[model samples]
Target: MEYIYASLLLHAAKKDINEDALKNVLSAAGIEVDEVRLKAVAAALKEVNIDEVLKSAATAPVAVAAVPA
Candidate 1:
């Protein structure tokens, strides 16, 4: 979702991930801002550690398929 992307962009840029910031990013990107969703995302990320989340995601294992000879 664009909302999540906006949050990630802010995190990547070391900006504050708040409703206002999310609105600015969305508006700048020509996407319509949804206040309800923005607030929800901001609240959800309030206690999240983006760095740790990304690190864990990077280290998560993936299933590989075996090729038949």
Candidate 2:
């Protein structure tokens, strides 16, 4: 979702993921910010460790299916 991506952008930029900051980022991207979603995102990520989640996601294995030759 755009909201999640916006938060990721903020995390990558080393910026705080607060409602105001998220709103600014979304506005810059020309996406309308939803007040409810913004509040939910800020609350959801309040105690998350972005770095840890990224590391786990990066190292997580993907299932690839082989096609018949």
Candidate 3:
């Protein structure tokens, strides 16, 4: 979603991820901003360590199914 991308952009840029920041990103991208969703995303990531999460996700094993003959 655009919201998540915007948040990631903010995080990657070392900028604070809050409602105002999210609003600016969304507006600049010409995407309509939703107040409730913005608040929700900010709150959800408030205490999250994105780098750790990404690391763990990257190291996690992937399940691959065998191809049928």
Best by TM-score: 1
lDDT of 2 by residue, 1-69 (tens): 898899999998999999999999999999988899999999999888888998998888966768779
Q: Is candidate 1 or 2 superior in TM-score?
A: 1
Model 1, 1-69: lDDT tens per residue? 999899999999999999999999999999988789999999999899989999998888856768789
Report the candidate with higher lDDT, 1 versus 2. 1
Per-residue lDDT of candidate 3, residues 1-69 (tens digit): 898899999999999999999999999999989899999999998888988988898888966778899
Model 2: weakest 10-residue lDDT segment is: 59-68
Of models 1 and 3, which has the larger lDDT?
1
Q: In model 2, which regions exceed 4 Å deviation?
A: 65-69
Candidate lDDT values, in order = 0.93, 0.92, 0.92
- Compute the lDDT for candidate 1: 0.93
Estimated TM-score for each candidate: 0.86, 0.86, 0.83
